[model samples]
Target: MKLVSLITAFSLISGLVEAGNERKFTTIQPDLTEIRKAQATAQPYEFKEEYVPGKVFDRFYNIWLENTDYDKAAGEPHMKDLRKKGITLTNYWAVTHPSQPNYLASVAGDYFGLDHDEFVRMPANVTTLANLLDAKGISWGEYQEHSPYPGFQGFNFSNQETYANDYVRKHNPLVLMDVITSDETQLSKIKNFTDFEHDLEAKKLPQWSFITPNMTNDGHDSTIKVAGTWSKNFLEPLLKNDYFTEKTLVVLTFDENETYEEPNRVLAILLGDIPEDLKGTEDDTFYDHYSLISTVQENWDLPKLGRNDCGANVFKIIADKTGYENIKVDMDGVYNNKSVEGWFSDKHIPLPPPHCCE
Candidate 1:
């Protein structure tokens, strides 16, 4: 009897070892120390050719050269590490310049086409992609991290309005909006990132969810290492989370590429619930903020609303046939033609508006 028990124990131990070996971990981590060190070495400011102006195609081609270099020399290894751990996106695009506009564009499908931070409520005439989702009876929520102060809690709330609303209202205006407006209780559904634990524990997940991590960690002005680390720490686990992996899609992208001229490249990462043809692939498709709006419209079958809509192309990052079965075309072949030297043409020109408030 003792010999038989010993044999069973040995078999269990061997199985554990094999299972451990089969699991792969991501290579990237939010390394604040490394990020700070790298930033220390960066020169105060320097120009690069990628910022120069030309045709859209030529401009992107030139920018790609340096971006390829920057990624290869700095962030490439981390990207590979992410891929090994199942975090990847074949084609992604930065939604806009500055930050807030991109965020608005993602949900609204029009940059609201605003030029300033004026907090006017989105016009009733403008149809938002979020509204479209609401109509379809698909559930959705915005998972804001460290909010409760910025008035992001509910839909239709803005950062500027948090003052009168107090902590919860200030932080999550979106929730408040739905509370007052949406009859389906969609506002109740919007939650803080921490709330993810409860949903996971209860085994409840909506068809669509939008998550936004806080300022410090999201790679806005922070060092790439810090951003990458935050991404790894939060995302690595979520990728493995059973609920997220099966039908969910995770999009990681910058609001804007910022002022960097060299590399002139920002990131767009998509993962989860992708079709076989679209999975584990990388696309050099030329795209911008409007592309995201276009994608959301296409996914929900919503109508396009602005000037960009007429010509905008949505690059399908996840082509899950079983779920989002929209046929995709090659976005690269679409006309990249521009009347002027592309948007970057103004890089060297004198600014119509000064750095200070005009």
Candidate 2:
């Protein structure tokens, strides 16, 4: 009965995801302006905990953008300018196609074979990077550009006037995992950009943060140029912000590549309190979505997820700072263009149990 019920739930979730493609968001106003006005009334929860220092950096911030091939993104005027301010990850690859899976993999160390941008949720038993950080009393949060409110579980909110995909659930990694979504306290930490502003001003930002801009700003609905411009404008001022950058590691990266036929390489820029000699440099070491998890774990000595993160390379800079050697991957034919079968996939192959201590 337990096994059957679990399978039934997975099938139902898959059905809802397929049906959600055309469904208008009912919880929030369909009009983007009205939605923003309404969301203003939602109290943004302020959470601040002890700053657990990591080996290489005190705080880590990752800003995620949308689809753009490595060269296309790297060649953008604003991106090029940003590259000169920090280390450019020349060989960093995304884990898979579409977008959401890469975000999921970044925190969970695996995407469980999800293939598309769908309204799916993981079971409560599944844990993520948050748990690892929580275990060590480290603080973390996610700031999504246009999320209606903290702890929102809607499929996709759009502009009723333009019918554009605005704040999407798929782009927000923590929302997909039930481990975070099920807990009200954890959900409060998954806030919008407005909350980010409040936190930033109060100097109450978490030790680790995952930031995702709106669909348009992130280039999902626009071009790489727009995303690059938005990224530079948003991150440039923080370079001198004392509260934000003392021994901090800021990463600018994409969820996945725009081209499905090519390898899933994306342009990533490393900045914020980096060693001066490493700035304006290019690191060609092979990396993927799992590298995000590995890098965080390496810095904080967090427990292994016992999945892909176990084998993923830590950020070379973090490795060098912490005296940990990063592994070099031989990328001959590791093209993660399509996802395989799992609980969320159309095939609905049951997901394996989470290996907490593998």
Candidate 3:
């Protein structure tokens, strides 16, 4: 059968677990002796290579916060402090409701209409931003806070003691794409915070990365203030570290807004090597998750995913490098509060096919 027909057939079966949104395994139990042993014995993954100079920044990293409205995040003290140290993206919009789709969009260029947080393994042929990065010999990795082990395939993992939401697969961008997860070499790149510390100290960090905080720290189960303070504490010393901040562009952004009644605007900041005059400035460029992909592609002269990323705006900080013009979105009748029907949506539409042939 064809890929589309196979997907359609899987969709029709209620009990079968062929692919998209199926529970192959339950959540990981960190307290179990065997599980603890596995986690302890798992080797940490690292990616280090010669710096591939980009048009502007040499290193690109993004830290995603939880559901937060633009105004709420802007008013927070720590967020304001971070804003003063970087360029604030005032017109950044998330693609849809909930967090999973937006996270997936950051790497995949499209979400395949994912509307909720669930265990999903896209077909192997789907290409991602990582693929583009690899084509240029640019190393990449994912830092997942509180994940039980390196390249963990579980759907979710709670804080063993408090039983709070710790690390969820939904917030992980690279795990959603089978192209990366199915390959052991690529999968090993997803490591925990301990590995992050080791890599940071050893200077084995990759040029490109997506960092996801645990639920409480990201404000998914708490408040935006928690996320902001954690973000500030996490990034403050890195700014002073020469190795970490050298030609690095770090973005502190949210997955989506807390309110579904308003436009899906979220606060995003660009941090790294800002001049005295440009610091604390605001860029009202219309941007979304896909913009990050386009910005990276333009900076590194990489191939486009040929999805929403192809037309997304490049960041103004490096617009001079690409000479690409960005437009301010007229928000008169624009509303992205709701997600359009797609494969994972409640009433599924079959337009956006899984890129099994990419």
Candidate with maximal lDDT: 3
lDDT, residue 104, candidate 1? 51
> For model 2, how does the per-residue alpha-carbon lDDT over 1-358 read when each residue is reduced to its tens digit?
3423554575466555432233122232246565577566656557657788889898989999988999999999999998888999999989787887888888887787677776777778888988999999999999988777887767777755787888888898998888998888888888988889889899999988999998999998899989999998998889879888898999999998988998888999999998789889999988888888889998999988776777577888988778877666667776778664455654335567654532
Q: How high is the lDDT of residue 75 in model 2? A: 94
Clashes of 2: 0
List CA RMSD, all candidates. Answer: 23.1, 6.2, 5.7
Candidate 3 backbone collisions, by pair? none
- Over 4 Å off, model 2: 1-41, 160-163, 346-348, 354-358
Candidate 3 residues 1-358, lDDT tens each?
A: 2533553564455233333542232443345676678776777666757889998899999999999999999999999999999999999989887788999889988776676776666677779999999999999999999988888877788888998889998999898888998888898999888888999999888999999999999999999889999999999999998889998999899999999898889999999777668899999888899999999998999988877786678999888657977755566755666654455543224435433223
| Per-residue lDDT of model 1, residues 1-358, tens digit only | 3423543464354333322122121222224454345434432111111211111100000001011212432354555555544334334444334344445555554442232322323333445545655565545555565443212322222234443221122222233222223433444455555565655565555545556555445543345566667767776777677655665555555554444343234566555554566555665555555565555555555555543443445454432321433334454323211111111122232212211211
Q: Count the backbone clashes (under 3 Å) in each candidate.
A: 20, 0, 0
Per-prediction TM-score: 0.56, 0.87, 0.88
Looking at model 1, report the run of 10 residues with the lowest lDDT sum: 57-66
lDDT of 1: 0.42
